[model samples]
Target: MPVMPVDRRTLLKAGGALAAVTIAGCTDSPSGHASPSAPPGPDVAVAPDWAGFGRGLDGRLYRPGGSGYAAAHQLFNPRFDSVQPGGVVKAASIADIRESVLFARKNRLTCVPKAGGHSYVGASSIANGLMVDIGNLRSMSYANGVLTVGAGARLYDVHAFLDRYGRSLPTGTCPTVGVAGLALGGGMGVHTRAYGLTGDRIMSMQVVTADGVFRPCSPTQNADLFWALRGGGGGNLGIVTSFRLSTIPGGKLGLFILKWTQSQAAAVIRGWQRFAREAPTSSWANLHLDARSDGTIAVRAVGVSTTGSATAAAAQLESFIGIRASSRSFSQKSHLEAVRFLGGGTSSPRTGFTAGSDVLRGPMDASTISALVGAVKARAGAGMTASAILDPLGGQAAKVPTGGSAWPWRSSLGVIQWYVGLAAHPTAASYNSARSWITSGHRAVAKASAGGYVNYVEPGRAIQSYYASSFARLKTVKRKYDPANVFHTPYSIS
Candidate 1:
C-alpha cells in the first residue's frame, strides 16, 4: 500500500474540515533540466536529437533549456523530490508517441511515458533520460456502446466527456489519477463492487512496444500482451497510448457516510466483515479510520448502493452495526457526483504525501483491529494520521475466474489501503516507527490472506510474492512481451 501521512481529526468533526483541501497542483522542479543531464550510472550511449523528430510529429519539441520543459515534467505526486528529466516530448497524438519511441530506440535511451503523473512511486515520470508526456492526448470517442480514450486522459476528463452521453466506465475514485495506470493495474473504486475494475471494461489497447512498433492488443489480437496489460502493471510493457473501454448506462446511486468512535471500532469491524459477506452486489462499503490529537479514534463508513434506494440500503447496513448515525448525507446523484463524493471531493489538497496499500481476502480478527487502532492513536500526537480503508471486491471482479487476466487476486474479498501521512521532515526514528506500524499491519493481515494487489505494493516485499500463485504464469508472459526487460521498473516484472 502507498503510505502517505495525513493530518488527524475525529471522523465526525474531520469530515467538512478535511474536505476543503484542494488536490490539484504541479509537482515540478523550479529550474527545469532542459539539457541532457547525465544520469548517475556510467555513460553508455548518446541520446538522439528527438527535438527534430518531435517537431515533425507534433510541432512540440522540449529540449534541454526549452521553455516548455518545466511544465512537461510536473506530476501529481509531489513526494517525488527528484530533478526533471533530461528531455521531454509532449505528444499531441498517437503518431507523436510512435515517433518518440522510434527515436528513443535509435538512440538506445530509456524512455518513460507519463500521463497524469499521479504515480506515487515515480514510475510514470522518471528523473532522467527521454520522457514522453501524453497529457495533451485527451481525445474521447464513443460509438456502439464503447468509449475509446487516450491513455493520457484523467478520470475527471473521461467522466465529463461521457456525461453528455449519459454513460460511465469503471474507474478509480481519484479524479486526478491517470486512466492509463489505473486501468492497467486493475482499478478499484466506489463502483467496483457493481461494475468490476477499470481493466475489466477494456476492449483493446493501442501501445508502442519496446521495438518501436505500435499495435492494437485485445483478446483477438496480441492476446498475451493484452492479458499482461490488464494487471501486470504499467511501464513493464510498451507505452499504451489509448484504451477502448466498455461503457455502462449511467444512473443515480445512493451514497451514505456513517461514523463511530475508537471504543466501538472492534465491534464495527467485526460487524462490517459479516455485512460484506451478505451485502448485495449492488451495495459497496468501505471503513475509514482517522486519528485525533486527543488520542481518540474516529471510524467512518462510506458506502454506495447502485439500486438507488437509500432507505433499503441503510436498512441492510444497519442490520450489522447498531450505532445510529449522527449525520446522514444520502442522495441520488449522477455518476460524476458520486465520483466527486467518494473521491473525497475536489477540494482535497494535492500536497506530497506517502501512501501504502494492501489486499485482504479473509477475516481481520478483532484483536488485530484493536492493535492497529492503538498504534495509530499513539502516533496521532506526533502529527501522523492512519487510515484503514476496506473496499469490497466480490462483484464482477470475482466473477472473472482466476488466471483469466494478469490481475491474479480475483478471489479477494476486498482491498485494505493502510495509509499514514508525513507533514514535516521525516526523522529516522519517526520513519522507522511508521514503517514498522505499516509492516506489522501487513503481516497481521497477511496471516489471514497472502494475496496482495500489485497496485498497492509496500516496501521490501518481493514482486513475485505479491503475485502469489500467479507469479509463474506472469513470468512467462513477461518473458514473451518484455524479454530484454526494457520496460522494467521497481517491483514490476524483471
Candidate 2:
C-alpha cells in the first residue's frame, strides 16, 4: 500500500489519509504529557502487532513509491543516494517516538532516529531500515535564561529562538545541524573556548530507550544515562526527545576574516598552532587551509573575539599573523549573523565531500607542522577543494575530567579536521582519491594527536577512536538501557 509523505504542517488532518488503528503496549507518560523512568527490560513482545504501525502512528508515514518519499528520507550527502530506507515515519511528538519505537521493536525493523539528517556516514538514513524522522518535533523556548530544545530542532531554529531573547547557546556552525545530534556528539564552534562544548551546558534531557520507557535524565537522576547522553554520539543507546540547556550572552560579537597568500600558508599554520593554544578564552578561532583548483595553498582564519569590538578581534588576529595578511575583513555582528556566515547562509554548497577529525593534545613541533602542511598540499594538488582546519579547544573545556562526560576529548588543546571535497559526480578514481587523501592526512597527524571527533564520521573506523577509554563504560550503559539494541547505527555502541 503506497502512502504519501507529509511534513508536520499538513499531517493527519487530511481526511482518509491513513488507517486509524489504535496502538497498544505503550506505558503511560510519567508526567502529564510525557515524563520519567521505567525499569529496563526487553519486553517488546507485549507490543501490538507491527502491521498496524502506520495507522497507530500520530504523524505521517512514507513508503517507497509514495509522494515526497525520496525527499523525506534524503541524507545530507547525495553521494549516499544509492542507499534507501524501507520507510520513513515523520514523528510529530515524543508520544510518536514511543509508538515508532514499539512498532520497530515489535516488527523487528532496524529503525534509526533522524533529526537534521546531517550525519557524514549516512547513519541517519539506513538501507532497508525504518527512519524515525523527528525533524518536525522542533518546539523551543527560553525563560529566565534557560533554553529548552526539542531534539529535532535544527541549529538555525535554535539560534533564532534564543536570539529573540537576547541570548544564545554555544553550538556548531552548520545551521541545519540538529540540536540533539550536535550536543550528543560534543558540538564545537567559535564561542566554544569562551563558553564550552554545547553538550557541557545540557542540564537535563528526555530519552526513550529500547524498552519503550520514557525517562528524564540529569546529573542527579538516571545519572549514568544522563552522563552518556551529554557527549556520546546520537542513535547509540537510545533516542533523545528534548534537552534543557543553559544559555549565554546573545548580544553582538566581534568577527575577523584574515587571509594570506599561498607562500604564507606554512608560517600561518605554524603560528596559529602556537597562538591558539594559549590565546585568551575570550577568543575562539579556526584556521582554514584551502587548496585552490590550480593547486595553490591559501590560508584564511575566521573567528569571533567575544570582545564585541571589531578593532580588538583584528588586533588579536594580527598578533598571530605576525606576517601581513593579503587581506583582512572585520565586523561586529549579532551572534546569529556570525553563525549564518559560517553556515554559508541558507543555501550550502552541496558538492559531495567526506572528512575526518582528531583531537590535538598540545602544540605541534616544527616537524609535525611540516608533515601536516605536506598532507594538505598533496590533497590540493589533486585539483579538488581541500581544507585542513585547526580549531582551538581548551579553556573551560579542559577543567572537566576526561571521564566527567562521555566525550573523552576534554583534555585536548585543539582539533585537527582534515577534509577533501569531491566532484559532484565522482568516478572510482575520484572516490579513491578523496578517501586516500583524508586517510593519509589522518595518519600524518597520528603521532601529534589521538582520538577522533564523533561528528565527523568515517565509514570503517573503530568506536574506540571516538570514545577512547570511555567506550567500555558506554557499552555497559548500552547493555543496561538498550540490551536488545533497538536504536542502532553504524557507530552504535553495539
Question: Lowest summed lDDT over 10 consecutive residues: which window, candidate 1?
Answer: 1-10
Tens digits of per-residue lDDT for model 1, 1-494: 12111110111213455331111111111111112232344454654666567658763767666886766676554444344666678787778787777676566556777776655455555556677888787789998889998898877678878888989887665665668877777777656777887888888989988777888898888888888888776677788989988887778878777767667777777777766677887887777666655656677677778888666666666668776655566767677776566556542344443444566766677667676566566666565566566666777877662225787777777666655555433444655666666676676565555555655554556777656776787788778765655554455666
**Which parts of model 2 have CA positions greater than 4 angstroms off?**
1-51, 347-351, 401-403, 423-425
Instruction: Give the local distance difference test score of model 2.
Output: 0.68
lDDT (Cα, tens digit) per residue for candidate 2, span 88-196? 8899878888888877776666668888766666677666667898888889988898998889997768888888888998877565667777788877776778888
Model 1 lDDT, residue 280, Cα: 81
Q: Compare the candidates by lDDT and give the number of the best one.
A: 2
